[model samples]
Target: MRTAYRVETVRAAEAALMARLPDGALMQRAAAGLAGACATILGRVYGARVVVLAGSGDNGGDALYAGARLARRGAGVSAVLLGARAHEGGLAALTRAGGRVADDPFAVLARADLVLDGITGIGGRGGLRPDAVPVVRAARGSDAVVVAVDLPSGVAADTGAVDGEAVRADATVTFGAYKPGLLVDPAREYAGAVRLVDIGLGPHLPSVPELEALQHADVARLLPVPRVESDKYRRGVVGVVAGSARYPGAAVLAVAGALRGGAGAVRYVGPAGQAVLARYPETLVHAGPPGRAGRVQAWAIGPGLGDTPGVDEVLESDVPVLVDADGLRLLDPAAVRARTAPTLLTPHAGEAAALLGVARDDVEARRLDAVRELAARYGATVLLKGSTTLVADPRGDLPVRVNPTGTGWLATAGSGDVLSGLAGSLLAAGLAARDAASAAAYLHGLAARRAARGAPVAAHDVADALPGAWRDVIG
Candidate 1:
């Protein structure tokens, strides 16, 4: 798992590390890494025009020190100081290495090959400060390849919220570990590409992280593979309650995903049985209420079930349940809170906004807060789907899972239905609610990227690619 820590935690860790190290040792280590990254980006540092945007804080010091290193290697470096006071030691070092403070910030920025953004650090609360706004704008507008020092100037490091205008960097060279903002959006969008440079933060940090992303090894461990003695009855069965007369395609897509989600059997109950059977003839179809849909290890409710007639019945069952789409609309919070088994709720921004009685824009803006709030309120594992898919648990002991694999092309209809079925199947296969949700999201996004392949893809294409995605991960 790739983990991220909160600002306070990071600060404490840095302080602890600094206490053990020699005077100015940590900064030099950071500067060396930053300079190396800049040199790599510039290809040949010799005579390369490098511009550093320096502010008042340690971020500016880092940039200046890095600039000094680059200057010594024959790069023509200039510092466009935005703060009232500069790092005196860093300034002297840069001067000694043949770099100068820029007489014209804009002029130097306009023709620079690379621009290092040291305008703000993790401690910064809001957008760019007023004095540094013009300098940031000039750097952004320039042809220079912009690289943020730790994070983009205007993004919240812990919340991933952008209050106002922020620096949009081509790449971000982060120190130590990943921040929540770098993994989520709208801050994630600002940080184009992220590279982590370890500065020995691991020993100083705690075990529990604020956020985490599951990689292939993690997902593979969570997935259930068939055993020699395993049979259909032992492998687990997933019951899907979805679709209506008005939208039969939802059932088909849901069943399609469930079929490949490591579940040995899929029992579908809804008005769209004919549609489901037409697509997946192997599916066990039932045209009655979900109560009589035979025994199932887990249940996935509401994709296209317009009125959600049997939602209560499924929610009352002892088995784990996944609620999504129209089912989320008819849900009773009290009933969800009363459930004994695990419940996972999947909601897009609009649905989540409605549940929290807030604007969709608000939910979209603060996805981490929204997901946590919903998970607490509903007493269930909440998966907020968007550009960055987040899975939050109410217990709050585990770090919120951020899905790393996905493409913009996944913004298509019926994708959520596929995800619901897949996650529900994983739940039936005996993974914990958080693990099921995270693993399902990982595979779903990977499948979407595989199916799309830089082209427009339908929802069924993503469902069909699940096996390939699973194979890729396990391989």
Candidate 2:
């Protein structure tokens, strides 16, 4: 699992570690790591021109000290100070090592081979300052490979929201642990690639993190493997209510996902029963309403269920229910909150925006905030699907699960339906709402990546690849 801490947590940990170490020891350690990373990026550092965007505080100090190391190694390093006062000690060290502060920031930036963005640290908020805007633009516009100090400037360290102009780095060298911003999107999109440098602050940090991404081993632990005594009934039956006459493929796709989601049997109830049976004859099909769909451990409702009456019946069931696609549209907040059973709502940006009564752009820009708000408003576990899928629980105590596995190929239609069915089946297999949602997303994204393999993949391919994805994780 890849865990990330909030800025406050990181600062507190840093302060505790710094108290035990000698004066300037921690900064030097950070600088050494930063310089090593810079050198690795610039293979031939002997005559490499490096520009450091130095700002106020420790971030600037790290950059300046790193520039000093580069200067000593025979690289021509220039510091473009963006604040009123640079790190005095660091500036002096850089000067002594033969690195000079450049008066013409743009001229040097335009000709630089690499740019170090220390313009803001994790604590800095609200984007780049006015004076630093042109320099950041020049660095980006140039051929320089930009690298951020901790995180890209102007991004919300905790929430991963970018409100204004921000530095877009080719790579980011983060210290100690990963910040929440570096894992989630908007800010993640700005940070091209990330490398972590250990500064020995692990012991000072807390056991629980602010956010977590489950890897293969973590998912393997969470996945339910059938026991010797397990039967079809004991393993769990997933009820899928999906597709209309207008779009029967949604039902087939959802069933495909549910079949491979570790559920023993899939009982599909909708208008598209004939279509589903055609593809999967083993599916127990019912042409009647979802109320008469018989026994099921959990119910997956709403992929292509266009204005259907079955949604209300499924929501009223005592079993766990997953709401997605058209079901998201017909959701009554009061009804959803009134339910005694667990409810999971999976919505893409547009669906999420409609649920919150906000613009789609607003939802995309602040995904963390949006997912949490949706979970609270709906009084259920909410899965906000996007480039970075997030699962947030209504209780708000647990850290939001950030899904790290995914490719652009997952944007295909019906991909979300597949996800909904898979997660619902997990719920049937007795995984908690948060665990089910997060695990399903991890597999779904991995399956998509495997199926696509640098080409476009249809939604069916992703669903078919789920079994392989599960095997890979467990093995």
Q: Which candidate is the best by TM-score?
A: 1
List per-candidate RMSD values in Å: 0.9, 1.2
Which 10 consecutive positions of candidate 2 have the poorest summed lDDT? 306-315
- In model 2, which runs have C-alpha deviations exceeding 4 angstroms? none
Measured against the true structure, the TM-scores of the candidates, in listed sequence, are 0.99, 0.98
Backbone clashes in model 1: 0
Off by more than 4 A, model 1: none
Worst 10 residues of 1 by lDDT: 119-128
User: All models: lDDT?
Assistant: 0.92, 0.93
- What are the per-residue Cα lDDT tens digits for candidate 1 across 265-360? 999999999889888999999987998989999999999999859889999999999999999997889999999999999999999999999999
Measured on C-alpha atoms, candidate 1 has an lDDT of 0.92
TM-score of 2: 0.98
